[model samples]
Target: MMRFVQGKTALLVSAIMTAMLLTACDGDDGQMGSKGDSGVDGASGNNGLSALVSVTPLAVGHAQCAFGGQQIDTGLDTNSNGVLEMSEVDSNQTQTICNVTQNTLAVDLVGRYQSGVYGLSAAEIVDYHPLSQSAFVVNAQSGKVDVLDLSTLTQTAVQDEAGYSLNNIAKKTELNISVDTGLTLLGAVNSVSVSGNLLAAAVERGDALGNATQGNGIVAFYRLSESALPVYLSFVEVGALPDNVTFSPDGSVLLVAGEGEPNSAYDVDPEGSVALIAIEGGVPATTATVIDFKDFNIGGTRNSELNPLIKINGPGASVAQDLEPEYISVSADSQFAYVSLQENNAIAVIDIATATVKRIIALGLKDFGLDANKIDASDKDDAINLQAYEGVYGMYQPDTIASYRWNNTDFIVTANEGDARDYDGFSEEARAEDLNLDPNHPQFAAAQDKTQLGRLKVTTSMGDENNDGLMDKIVAYGGRSFSIWTAEGQQVFDSGSDFERITAALLAMNFNNNNDENKGDSRSDDKGPEPEALAIGQIGSHTYAFIGLERTGGFMIYDITNPFAVSFVDYVRNRNFDADFAIDTDTGEVEGDASLAGDLGPEGMKFIASQYSPTGLPLLLIGNEVSGTTVVYQLRLQ
Candidate 1:
């Protein structure tokens, strides 16, 4: 027995030395030695290192490992045994096998690009050029399109840290459309849409600055160059004041929303219309088919009686003139176009194939008296006191609209950023304090008091619910939340006061303020956290809607997969409220200073999925008009 034990001990020592040598070698060509039987009493012989243990997988990629009741974090399991050897523990290893999934989404501020041209409001509309890995931003005030190259962005490793830092670089090329066309472009570049090689831009033309010429708007088609610049191809005349333009999914058609706003003097109002241009063989047709609202008069008349729900009191002479198409959203199938009639507080559905009005859906007023829909109408209140009232009403005047298909059903989402016809010559906005309330009503006592009503701003055009031609109640602009409607214009879901409530909770003292990023309730009297822009994208197994607040200046992300039970994901804002405002008091124009603030007034947003993202991660691009800035964010999913 003594002789047998000595021989077994010698064999075990030789086997251990051979295993050590094999682990010392770089490659896995060395086969693991055969395991010997355990010693008596089940104890590991030779310094407690188990000789029979062998790692099933020598190389572990992004996986966890344990040895001796301790966690092994190193990427390389140097020893053939699964246990971590003391000498094999190296902190310099690049990979780590974490127990938990390390891919959790890290919402980080990756890049911010400034326009440098102060007050130009450089970012109104942004579209990504997938082939070039670039972004096209419309400089609204400068009448120029800026192209930004995103491929040059690099991530640098932080010293003595586990994560990396991205460099905020701004390299852009400004393409002035006026330089190529020789036509004086006015009212900024309202919208931009991109297809494979075609880039469409809608530029409102005017006889002079600030005066939109009647029936003079144009849609310019440009071919993207190999050098990442837009080469002007040709332009076609559309209607007056083309506010928004978009391309079909298959690039077969182009739709334009011609606002046709009336002059300040309430005279010379052109009919609001939409233009459809067919794209044949990568070229837009010379002329567009103009679709107007003359044929679909509700009462068979062209006056305000055409649509009883539309209150045309400000400057518009007729129903057709009052229906200003603020934004255009094309259906997923490219067969329908939904136009948002902002001031009219209605949505017009148009058949793209026939170029005719299908039906007009009036988005009726929202009752603020309900408990689910409370609002802080008074800016005089020190804090955000959302209370239900009996007589207050709000118009669902959506400014930006988007259509998407969920579970094979088509739905339209609107950002209810209301608008009033507040012009120099003809103004329709008045303080709530100036309006008279019904004395018999219970809220009349509170309305007569000057504290809250004096500070509240309401539109005078939409009141007089009895149709007696007398202002009986007060109606305010903007619903202050987003709404989901069916393709046929039936309300499916509404965010109610979630926008204001969530913003108040997240921003605290800085809720309901303007784009300057200050902490004040100044904007509460007008529009509370006015939701202006919306973009939707599917990331992994969830669909998200990115809502941008034009007043509060932040993003409200929601998981809209189940429209009935939508859940909030996150709220992010990048702004500097302490920035000084450069204002021209006489002209009533404010110049943006990017150095003093982050992005402001997110008027346009675009979501890029990971498959098409240049950084191999999902991205969200935001165009801030007030700050004339564009920011790119990377979404890291766990």
Candidate 2:
């Protein structure tokens, strides 16, 4: 709620044709501007009212604001190093930048988490390599992988991660090539991965996400050699939905994690798999061996509804669901793969070399599948989907599952849902209907009769009493409530009187944010991802969860120095909403909220912590999805 008017140094300049032709506005102070020009839906709202300042101004000192809101917001310290203040003055006439010194307020359009290298195009980049500026980002709906120049906005290259190439590469001739005629000699690929100088991705015929069908998921390769543009090569077809591709720390081998289904909605389960493409100095075959998602965590419970329904679709079709393989994080040594099975609320530990699912950890156990189920499903305008309605259709509650490492061996956070507050929700009676029992869709219209889960039944610390830092170890905070856990999964924290975790799940935060606030940790060669977990929780001295209340509640800063008793700092902004945070270790400068970039549903993100940059600052890559549009945010901490 920090509000401030930028020094529109550019608005002081001349006019743009787009803004001027809006039938000129009278100099009335209270005028709301012509009743939203009625020409095109969203066309030509850009013409400026011709302010005298320069338009492309740089961020300067922060300014304090007395009021703020949609039009003129208020509340918030404008001088925080990472904060950007915001305020909209008269249509087409407002400050574009507000850099205050108070340490709190922030600007809406400010490039806090600017678009770095976008991964899915639909989502921002997840993990990025600072050394090569190469990253892993997906344009899921497009079934495309984009390699970007984080420094530059333009895309460096796009690879097809689903084309056929990596299957059985060890014995294929197209894969075994001389040291000279590199893999890049192949056609535009499907998927790609990179490490240090070695880069690789897979290829699959037809966009895998576009269909509920299956194809030969290929693996391709490319290396940035010492020569100018040294190498661009092909790996080979690996497997179906070879979802996540990764590399060994030494850049010796390439690993691809399969999501199993090309499209979950359509239910094409082509053996959830993985593939290990040999590095002939980083060359892959025209076809690679197809392993499976099972090699990870038994590939989660198979989608029952998708079995008979999954199939192939050419183009213009609904992108299937459940096929998402949320993430694949590797240990510092690349010995283990921490794979997340978001759909089933499970995290599997896999042995990289053996391609084995070593351990499958059940997360959020105290909560039932119907606990988070939605009951409101009225097709009418503003109609709500029924909750138990999902159960009646053979569905359980779904979790977002985008958790990642915050700072320790067992510490990582995943989102339970991408958008908890997007809908109005269904009634208890309307939700109880089981989807599985009604697979025939007989009473699809008679939804009012089914029973619902009754407000996320399950109470605080209901599960994980032992607190082992594992999912099952944590206790429930009570009644479909959102709670925080220790690395060992102990229910160490829950918002007191907080509405619930179902709606407002704590989002991205560095456990170190307030921890290192007073004693900043100097980034060292041995330093790991910051451990202090950062989250979007209740603000003020309140000891309760916000759980996404309709009203704004400000962000809470926690100094988790003592895991047993984490301390709360102060409230910054309440409702830029589902806020995400990232900080530059070297500069001590921070950036957050970049939420508006991904529509309102900004959820699931990854930050790249690779080798030092030539300029010395390590890089951070981020990605998120909202309202169908996937946006990327890439920014150097400094």
Candidate 3:
């Protein structure tokens, strides 16, 4: 059995940070800028790979991320409006836009799941496959990797999310049925990567159930076959709690972000660092290298307080206090690695070659949306002032990083939801969760701050108003659904338009009500926004993003090509039929929800150009976070 992390929410933290590692061509291709004072110079980073800028400009092939999926557990709403206007498949919305017709894809987290309709959960499916033929989905509640093969006509699982809560997976093709050691760690699977057939997993230390921690603090490996159990490899001890795992572009080196032994508690080493696991001659379990972030920043006290802010429960009452590495994603070329320091509210960048600290980029700023010179409330409050913030985690928690790559450059985007901190879900004795978990408990009134999270508006682009590279205007939105921002964190588009429609929907839906800022005796003054489901991909150069409102149905689209004037274009409702499998289980026929013509249930999206039309068309990969499984749809000009 697996044990829960010490704190309320222990996650992999990866904030946004972009850097490129290049080399001098034999000749002077002055085309590239002067190599400035080269820092972290070494082959530690997987060279040959270029940094990605945006997720536009598709690559050839019938499949450009063929489909998409997302698990809705966190904040999907923006404006804190209390309605589920985002879609039809939303939890509270009885009407659905899923199975309107035949041969369609729509999944409801609960509706489609209870009957074993679709094999998925509310906290599942974290990534897509590099081969584009499979989805490396994870059942976070359980260490299971649902390797769903999208190649054939039916939904046959190659690997179910059973054995472990498979956080990450890597395929090393070099092992032709060799290096077979089937040893596996329970919660250690934080991240995974493939380096020339060597599958590396960054395992978290500490026995979750034990009062005393017990993790080796290393980057471990497992050999594999297209089938059969995995082969055991070796481990390289690095920092405290190593949470994120990724291979450099060339697959030569492995970049790992350590949470410092206590992935969610205090760091045992006090040295926040990343480890480099080298793969020499394609052999498994080679030597490992370490890069210390504290070592570099220690040059002066100006940076002391910046050491990742870890969560603590008084001195040592066993209440669980630890720092954690939420997520880590490397450049396509493997030159730079981005790690999310969730507890610390920071993003750490690693230069593979030199195995040195590049820079630590902070996430969120309280005053992101405030006009630089405006005399606004957010500007005046010392509490909300945001200056490329690293967040105050006494309670408020941030998480998740969705990266978008354009051209050769890449960018890491972060999602800051509430939870992960102790908000009592809005209660006085919330730490006494048993009381707070009670929806009808009288003490529930004391628990008022449900909207613990908000968009980190970080920019001023007309399109990116209050730009944090995300649509902050949605803060006025009810139901925390998906919001699209420009590559530069500008306001791109929100699944729901104005607060009226959005809140009306959120309130009607009755989802995450305690999270409403409108409640009395709250932490932050009422901003009045409803919450929704989590969003997956808004990559490709498309018109908008399709959103999934838990019950209102699973489909909401945003016109993003034009950041300014970005509006709600489509929405789907509760006409769902495709929740469990690709095949229509209801009538044994294809179930297509045409209700999505105008406004429909569009939970999440993967951009794709329509075959018939040459212009950019988007494919809406829809799924219900609470009731059903998932569905796929195609979108066009209204």
Candidate 4:
């Protein structure tokens, strides 16, 4: 047994020594036998799984931000498909990105097109067509629409004959609204709107003397072409005196604000209405749905619902005849329209889908006694003295209204420009001193001084709440500011004395100057730096409001991103403050260096987004009624 054990051990040692010698000759024991199939391949290791990212554009009414922004999504490819699907996106990794974190928003004049003629309604309203790169200006003096080519437009600043810098733009052509149309358009073009290759012009019927008539107006459609004249299409009959016309976002509807103002004699008053024209395949209907204000008449169903603050004091006129639709702003979804009733100090809400009046919201009075709502109440004061008086309130009679969406909610912006019932038959405007005030009135002493509130224009229609012989409250004409209201007419934000304060700070030399004449403090008694034209635009991730000062000759910029916390951004005026400008009211002739006057009396404004801008930058187009010019301003970030 000992011999057998020793022989086996010796054999085992020999086998181990042989194996060791073979492994050393092959140097590392080959490669460990080729990676065996290992049963079913263990599911192929999931293709090494990848992490992915995606970016998409957010719209205006996004939940994350008021202004549009970028949405970034990131996730791991859990399914090994190499895609960050919505379902696979990691909510924790999702982010909302906006423009430059910190940037200065500004605007600079790019170009301006002048009409040579001045002191007339030569350029009242302006609208731009991106495809044609053209601006349609309401040349009321010629009763036509002047189309200016913006395709070849360069910076307005150029070398003049004397080698001095001058700004100018070329006129492309004039559209004859009277000719070629079967209807007799004897009146001037009041407004123009452009959307996708289509141009709409509001044409009213007039007498042979060019005076507005009680007949229905028309909205003429034209095809805008880049290389050809605007081809006239059919016309849709709206109510009398269509003051403003607008196209819906989807281009499927056209809204018209029928002013229906009475004649000078006040005997032929017509009912104010809103017309909704349906467009099928780009062609407007022959007739429109004229939504009247009859439901809000004195004895109508909605009469009791009307707010007491609404001014319905028109002589022998019902609510239907007194509520003039001065301007119309449609919601982003085109489902609703808000019409400004300037004379009535109210706004009519219309349901576009149903073509009916939803409600009428009366803009209440703005108390001047409050510190945030003071005004320069006297043109004869010889200085900018913004004062607040006890018992003094102002009617927010807005002129131009604009709508925008913020944080999934709707807001309406307005230029509280004010208006009065001044006619041969009736006039409600009176100077504060001219009004007979009660002895107990708080501002009676100040009302007797022309240098104080005496010269300020106030409406005699109000203030006499008890219908006594003497006045009680001193109600002024305009709020002298701009305001922001919710869709239901809840006052959210008001500029208050910002307009007057800003003008006084930046343009003290020309404070409250008039459009026709550079007379400082002349308009203070009426409407100090009347904020007439307003346009809201989106620059980067911020929404800005541009307000045009009709009296002071400039525009104001406010960052309205957080409407409740609006901040003043900037103010721009291209006018020559040193130059003396005047116009002959009777002769309609300029008596000063109109060329050096720059832009005056901004009556209409249009904002062009960067994507649709001719210069590939965001732009703002303004129509100056007094200067008869259309100025282009480029919005930028630095």
Candidate 5:
């Protein structure tokens, strides 16, 4: 953590002089010892320093300082040494000596924990058990959940011949899921959720050759133990390619999102569905209710309410097989579950009581013609530019979604991190500059209209107008922002250009850079920050939303108490984008231990309120995928 001292220099100098005078004359002189043995050690000197001195500008006219990792309120540092002296220690008295110099509240990086190999890969999703004061981290590649004891966490500084480094140490234990299942379960752990004493993890099972099993997935259940560990309880079989798992508000049900994604060959695709497993007295029901979307096929007339811009047919697949469920969020009343159909650009509402699909909310295209919706649409661009153009549309294909309530109304928030249906056998991508434009369309009168449609990369699956089998309009991927929608699927609010504008303002040195720390607009043409995961928590009297950026490697905080007028609170990144990549000289490939400058590719996060927090302060836990690390941040009101 970075520390700063703010106050009047003149006042500080005077205080130091006064402290020196007091130190010289205030101590009582001991009786002179005339004859002490040469080897005798006098009195064991006063037990070191009674107190460490530090001075900080009063926060709201009250002294605040941190000593020995604990925040304390002490009087002025009369010695001007940023440490409290024994004479200056007075915890009960308010310090009125220093004047307030700064008004901005700041976030301090109090703790950080590492998971996998330093430079390799490790963590993805994390869930915290407030009662046990422990955190569960999903190690996706290793197929294990590492349980970390938060009480053992300590901050230490080590100095070696090389240099001085600060480290956060904690005790950890791992529970490997593959040890029991073996090759039968070929995929990595995708997501995890915890409620009460139960923890649920979604594991995508497949064959020994790594081919996805036909509608086969596993939900591993575990019981949280008082020993700060999880004991395996049982497992339940569900649909194929289960990407996300969640628990109902009351913990009476477990919801799984079966993505059912196809193979690279574009063959043998399974239909997407949702599974609801009822829990009775901490035990799963004998049979799970699988809610499939075959009835709501894209080609069916009843499903025409879906975005007409969506391509009805994928490679070697039908509409029903293409709606892949990505993530899920339950209603506050536990009556409905909202699932994001990422690839289809729609949201599926499932009735928990009936265990059936109630409705599919289509998230229509985002218009880029307006100034607020402008984007830097080309990776080839040298600099970041936000400008509007005609005939450009983007799909709000959200990856992670959450739910909140305000004024008794329910709302769904989404991270529009766009995805494409690209496989080894079939890919649907095209550059706008390479496609032939429709002549009759008013926007593009000529074939070479560079201003409107030159550098944009669009999907060829949609935007075909005039029934001439020609591409008249361009459809891009991702909205590059977070959005709020009504339960009925109407758009309520969109962050629009705020993400880019705010990020640029905060991270001016590395704006629009990738996780590798490559500078310039390398990712602007792509998903642009790729807002992948979202978690909301209530702090004080306000509700805040934490949006994690997948590519840019950090999270943004927003005060969303009023959805219509959300305000940006802060932006934090823990990754070392500027660190040098270790490379093998012979093969020219990156090698060996990498620097843990910060967290990268945050896939999952959890927020703990102060009431349940071990530190008596709000906390945010993040699981970063690329860096394979989990970091715990203590939130303080400045």
Candidate 6:
């Protein structure tokens, strides 16, 4: 109930009562009348029928805000004008509302789209065009992006007596990345991003023989239409293996992460880099500013500045080549970009205005010895056994990352989905039991048994610090959790074991299940749940972080309005646990009822605010790689 602050009626009544007492006392000549028993306080007025709120976007350089925040105006509709006017606003309530926490938000699966192709990357990365009311999804299996029309997508449109059709939604068109570009080779679209009426796609280059090539990639541009496929504009050549791409918030720049992954034979290695393309007049510049990491190479100027904890383990590869930039996130002001170096377990800060590397912050290891950082370290155990091994640690090898502002300060969020350098020519991975542990180390006997810590995968390069052949400390691949970090890469909060604990309690039967197959406890030895995809959104002053669990087939939401005081909000999974969706032993293929399997292996996620949503409600779009499906969920606030 909204109370009004007014003094007209109450103050007038008190004034008249005082006048009557003064008149009565005047007749007694300098004698004051006794206060007749303090009169009872009048009852408060009823609340107004409705309280209205209006939000206006603030511009840059505002003295009272950072990165141009929202200006909120709230008032009671006294005149019933159906809009909050300046005169109706209460003077006492005029303020800039910031970070009001709420826990009433939930998500409901409203629509889904299936691409028929299973076990292939039919849908990997997804981006939406608000004006077009469509989603541009990266279909790596078909070498194109499948466009799905969401203008008519509704709960009723997708529902029927026999349930919804596998192909309920309509595929508007296929956006082939190689459409207008003249140069042709084995190409694959890795990522896509949309801003306003423009769309950008990152395409990786391959050798003519269809093998992975160590050559420069390309970032293609297009013009989004209201009811048709994107019109190709132009393409700019970037670094090797452009894995991820995104546009700055202001649409002034486009950034691409050149992963520069080496071939399986380890024959050629390219230097990882970032490309900054200036977007002018709705088209990319003729060339891009390529920012390479050569300064951090061995014996280079910045070589001595390297952090000791940053991993540089690639065989015969310089620091430039070993530091692979997997993902990119730009600050709200578009002044800087944070590039996640997954293999190196670090993040590179790039000054956008200067197009130069400002610094590289190394993400430290997570000590599992702490009680809060426990893990279920065995798939062969056949049960959820969460324990803390004293000598074990986890690398915060983040795959996808994002940036947000809280209280006008920037913070970064990462999905600590660890990766290993396992290839045909070089492999640094081994099961815990396969390696010989130091006899004097704690939990040494437990590491030797398959049902305990033996099944966990660990990197072989770091444990033997003394080069004594016997491992001293076990360093695992991924952190198995998400973390909030300062702009300088200092970890502020880590959801240690929350993912495992929540999944174990809610999905005990399907604990640690793999995405392709429904075998419980299979991924426990590997990265549990593998939080890869991430997106941040704001609803009614509260900010939320949505993390996608790649293996377990769902997403988790957390209240991140206060990064230091984060809390779990909701967990939703659409996969059918009862369905027998397992890989075939003979063909090594996932064969089961595709319709019942639901969405699996969420590779990419995008959040749409209410204003840009088709239904005028917040929505989340996810692209599931293994199941080859794209699903949509509407945010429902109670």
Q: Evaluated with lDDT, which candidate comes out highest?
A: 6
All candidates in order of lDDT, best leading? 6, 4, 1, 5, 3, 2
lDDT of each: 0.72, 0.33, 0.35, 0.81, 0.71, 0.82
Query: How do the residues 265-319 of candidate 3 rate in per-residue lDDT, one tens digit apiece?
Result: 4333244556777777666445567665443333543344443322222222121
lDDT per residue for candidate 4 within 1-638, as digits (tens), equals: 00122254355446445533443232122233356633332222222345566778653223343233567676666776767788878787666664321227656677778787787878888999888888889997677999888887553433223211234567878888788476674587889988788888998886444457677888889987768888999788889899999999889999999999888877777889899988888777888999998988878988898998999887999889988999999999989999999988999999999999998999999999997787888887788688888899999999999988888888999999999999888889999999999989988899999999899899998988788878999998878889999999999999878777766766774778888877778898898888889888998988888999887887888788887877666677877666676876456787768777777789999988998888888998899888888888888876
lDDT per residue as tens, model 2, 142-255: 444444444433321112221111111010011222233342222223334466676565444434355433564555555563323425454365555555566755565676
lDDT of model 5, residue 55: 48
Number of clashing residue pairs, candidate 1 = 5
- Please give the lDDT score at residue 367 for candidate 6: 92
Q: Which stretches of candidate 1 lie over 4 Å from their true place?
A: 1-106, 154-167, 185-187, 208-210, 213-215, 226-228, 297-307, 314-316, 517-519, 578-594
lDDT of 1 by residue, 1-638 (tens): 00122254355456556655544444223334457644334323233222232222211111132100112223235455666565655444322222221122456666667765444566888888887788889887667788888776543212211111223546567777777677764557888888778988888887553566564798888898556467888888888889888888878999999998877766667878999999998888999999888754446543342456766665536566777888888888888899999988899899999988887778888888887688877767777777777778888899889888888888888999988887777887887767665565546666655445556678777667787765666788889989989987789888887777766765665788876535477687887888998888888877778899987887877678777766556667776556666533233265554356566788999888787777788888888887677878777664
Each candidate structure's TM-score, on Cα atoms with residue i matched to residue i, is: 0.78, 0.44, 0.47, 0.82, 0.78, 0.82
How displaced is residue 419 in candidate 6, in Å?
Answer: 0.4
Q: Where does candidate 4 stray beyond 4 Å?
A: 1-103, 154-167, 207-211
TM-score of predicted structure 2: 0.44
Query: In candidate 6, how many Å is residue 537 off?
Result: 0.5
